[model samples]
Target: MCATHKAFFSYVWRKFLNMYRFSVISSFLALSCFLSLASYELPDHSNGEPTTDYSINEYWLSLFSGFSKDVDVFYVYPTSWYKLDPAEPDFCAIDHPTMLSRSKVVFDIQATAFETVGNLYAPYYRQADAAYTLSLPADKRWAVVDSIPAKDVIAAFDYYIKHYNKGKPYILVGHSQGAQVLMLLLKNYMPEHTGTYARMVCAYVIGYPVTAEFMSSNKHLKFAESAEDTGVIVSYNTQSPSVAPGANIVLGDEIGLVINPINWKRDETPATAEESLGSYMPIDAQGNPALIPHFADARINMAKGVIECSSVNETDMFNLSGKMGPEVYHSFDIPFYYYNLRENAQVRVNRFLAK
Candidate 1:
C-alpha cells in the first residue's frame, strides 16, 4: 500500500471511532466501509515526481469509455518507448507526444480484441523505456518497472474502479512491457483489491510469463486450465522452435505457466494453423495492418514454457523488432490468435455471468 492510501484510510478510522452514539456510529461506519470498498481516489498529483493525473482527460487514451455492457477491458500497451541515450530519464511520460499517438495505434490493433466483449480503458502511463528496461537484469528490470511506471498504472486503475467500474466484471490485457507491469500490478495491488479481483473474468497477460512463485505468493492467482475458466489468467509467450529454449520469455529458474492461445490448453498438445481463426498483423516495415486468416499455429514448448509457433514461417509475421532475436514471436502473441482471444473472452464472460 502507498503511504498516501494508508493515511487516508487511517483518517477514516479515526473519525469512525469518535462518533457519540453507538448506533449512529454503527450506521455511518457501515456507509463509510461501503464507500471505502467502492472506490479510492488517490491524492493530488502535485508532488511532481512524474505524477500522472488520472482525472485529466489527456492521460487516458480510452477507446471504449462509457459502456452499454456489464464488462470492461483494461489494456496496457507493449513497449513503444525506446530510449537510446543513457542521459535521458528511464521512463516515458504520460504526455510524450509520439508515445500517445503510438499508444492509440497499438490499442486499436491490440485492444480491439476485447472491444466486442467489453468497453476499453487503456491508460497512458510513464512506463519504462524498452531499451533501458530490457538492458538490465531481471531484478533491476523489476525495480525500474516498479517505480513511477507502477504508480501510474496503480493510480490509473484505482481511478478506474473509483469512477467507472461500479461493480462490473473486467478483464486485464497487456503485451510485453505492459504484460510485465500488469504482472506486478496483480502481485502488488490486487491483494488489497480482492473485491475488484473477484469480478475479473480473466486476465489476458499475453506475451509474458506468470511465474509459479507469483502463483504461490498470490494464492488467489490461477492459470486458466480451460477456455471457459473464470477468474484465472490466460498467458503464453510465443516463439518459434528455433528461438532456442531459454531465449523465450521464461524467467530464470521460475516456472512460467502457459496456455495455448488456440486450444486454451496447458499441455503440449499442438493446435494446428488450420484451427487458428486469424491474426491481426500490426503494420511493420514490411506491410500495412492486415488480418491474415489462420496465420500461425500454437503448441506449448514445455521445456522452455512458451508457445512454439510452427507450420507457418515465423519470418512471415509482420512486426518491428529491436533487441529481441527474430525467432521470438513476442509481438505476435495476441495477434496470432486474435479471433480466438475475442471469442474466448465472450465465452468466459458468458460462463461467469451464467454462474
Candidate 2:
C-alpha cells in the first residue's frame, strides 16, 4: 500500500473510534439522568420519631395568632402524596416538600371556604399516601389506611382541643381520606368525650363515602337536613348526572349520604346553576383564586346518594373525567361549591350561637 493512503486510513479510523466513545458515554449519562428523576423518593419518616408536637409552630399550617372568631375549624387535608414509594415510607413526614406543596393547594381551594366563618386551624399530620388504599384489597386497605393517619388526626385534635379550642364551638372539615379519618374520630372519640362532641358546630365530611350503616350506628351524629342545621354532618360526593351509583370511587353496593351544597338541601330537589355562588380553581403563581367556573344546576340522587351536577363544563380544569366516567369530580367537591359552602358555614354558625 502507498504511504499516503495508509496515513489517511489511519486518521479516519481514529476519528471513528472517538465518535463511538462519545456516543456511548452520552447514552449512559442520559439513562442515569432519567433513572435519577424517576427514582426520586420522599424523605424517610420511618425513624420511629414523634411526628408531631403541637407546642411547636412547625406542626401547624395555621395556628392561632391572636385572630378572633366566633368558632374554630380543625381541618384535615386529603391525599397529597401520590408518588410516595411504598418501600421508602408509607406516611409523609410533616416537613415533606411535595406534601406541603399539595397541602397548600388544598388549603387555598378547600379550607379557604371556612376562613370567614371561623378561626382556621390546619395541622400537618402524617397523611397516608394515595396508593395505600387503592393498592390494597378492600378488606385489608381500611386497616392500613386507618392506622398511622388516624392516630395523627386524633392526636392533633386532642392537642387542638386542649391548647387552642378553649371550649369554643368548632367545626370539623375534611375531604376524601381526611373525611374518613374524621368519621372514625367521631365514632371512637366523640362518644367518650360528650362535651367535645356537643361543642362541635358541624362536620363537613366531603368527597368520601359515609354509608347508611355507619350513620345509623352512630346515633349521636346526625346528617345535616338544612343549610342552617348545626351539630350535624354535611357530606356528599359529586359526580355527573350520567355517572351511575356503583361507578368510580363510589361502590355499587354502598348507600352513602348526599347533600347539594348549592341549595344546601338533603333531598333530590334541583338547585339551579344561578344559585351556585362560585367554584374556585387552584391559585396561580401569584396566589390569587385562579378561576371561578359555574355549572347549570345540582341535585342529590336519592337512590345513588351522590350529587349530580347538570350542564357541567368538562373543559374546566376542576371538572375532570376519569375511567369511571365524566362525572368523577372528587377533587373539586370543595372548589365546585366554594361560595355556597362559605356562606352556609356562617349561617350554621349563627344558628348554633343563637341557641
Candidate 3:
C-alpha cells in the first residue's frame, strides 16, 4: 500500500505551499486547519434548506461558467476535507472554509486546463475528509463515497442540467475524490439521462480509477482509446515505479483504465520526456507556476494499472505518498501533464463539434 495519511507538520504545509506557492491562488492553507475547525463549530450551516441544494448560488464556485465558449465544463473538486478528526462527521460541510479554499486552488490548477476549451462551472459538495476515508480498507471506502459526496455532486449536476446547461455540450472534470464522485455520477446518473449523456463531450476523471470492471459492467461507458475520442472517459493515477510496492490508494483490485497524457495511448509504450509539452511547476519558493519542459516521462504500469513517471521529484508532488511505501503521485497527476491536457481537451471538443 502507499503511504498512510501521515500527520507531519511540514508535509501538509510543504505539500500545499510547494504545490501552489499561493501565487495564482489565494492564501489557501494558512487558514485551512483553523477554518475547518471553525466550520465544525458552526451550529447552523444549512440555513433550513438542505445545504446540498444547488439551486442556491452559494453551492457553486463558478470560475468561467459563463465564459463565451461553445462548450461547458462541470467540475467537482477533490477531497479537500482535511480536518482530520475521527469524531467529525464522515463528510465535511459545503461551507468548510478549508475545503472551499483548497477547492479554489485545485480548481484553478486542475480544472483550468479545460477552461480554454469550455466554460467552467465547479460546485461545492460535502466530501469526506482525507484521513477518515484513507483509514478504511479500499473496498469499504465506497460506503463513504456512496453517501454525502455522491449525493451533493449528483444534485449539483442535476441543477447544472436544469438551470445552466441550456443544451450546450459539456465536459465532466474531477480529480481524486472529485473524480470518484464523477464516476458515481456517470454510472448511476448518466444512464437514465441519455439526453444529458449525449451532450457530454467527455470526462477527465484524473487521479482516480475507471477500472476495467467498471467499464465492463456499464456497456454504455467507454475509456479513451485516443486523444480525440468524444463521449469517453479519460482516467489514470500517477505513480512512480520505485515507490511503494503494495496496493495503491485509488486503484483497488481491478486494473484501471489508463491513457498516456503525453501520447494518449493505453498500452505500456513509453512516452519520453521530450514528448511532453512542459508541466506546470512552481518556479520558486513563492509557488508561481511555470511551464517547465521535460518535467516527466510517462509509461503505463500494466500490472499496477498506473502511469509510472520516475522522473518526478518527491518535493514537487509534496511526497503525498511518502508514508505508504513508494511514490503515489496523486497530487501531480494533472500538473505533470498540464499543457498536454489543455491541448487534448481542445482537440476532443473540436472533434465533437465538427461531427
| Best TM-score among the predictions, by candidate number | 3
- For candidate 3, the per-residue lDDT at 323 reads 39
- Shift in Å, residue 249, candidate 2: 2.3
- Please give the lDDT score at residue 205 for candidate 1: 90
Residue 305, model 3: lDDT of 81
Please provide, for model 1 over 46-155, each residue's C-alpha lDDT reduced to its tens digit, 9 standing for 90 to 100: 24575587888778889454537889999988765554444566566678875776666667668998899998898888866554444445666677777787788888
Model 1 local distance difference test score: 0.71
Winner on TM-score (2 vs 3) = 3
> Which residue pairs show backbone clashes in model 1?
none
Identify the superior model by lDDT, candidate 1 or candidate 3.
3
The regions of model 3 sitting more than 4 angstroms off are 1-51, 63-67, 244-247, 315-320
lDDT per residue (tens digit) for residues 1-355 in model 2: 2456335434543443333221101122222222332233333333365537777778788786676897999998887664323355556677888677767767877898898989999888777654434434444445555677777788889999998889999999999778988998998899999999999989999977788888899998899888888899999888787776566543435667888898877788898777777767433323345434453367898888888776554434222234324567776678778888998999999999999
The residue pairs in collision within model 3 are 2-324, 3-323, 3-324, 21-287, 243-326, 243-327, 244-326
TM-score of every model versus the real structure: 0.82, 0.81, 0.84
Per-residue lDDT tens digits of candidate 3, residues 71-139? 999988877656444456656778988777877777767887777888888889887665555555555
Provide the lowest-lDDT 10-residue window in model 3: 22-31
Instruction: For residue 352, give model 2's deviation from the true position in Å.
Output: 0.6
Q: Given candidate 1, what's the lDDT at residue 181?
A: 79
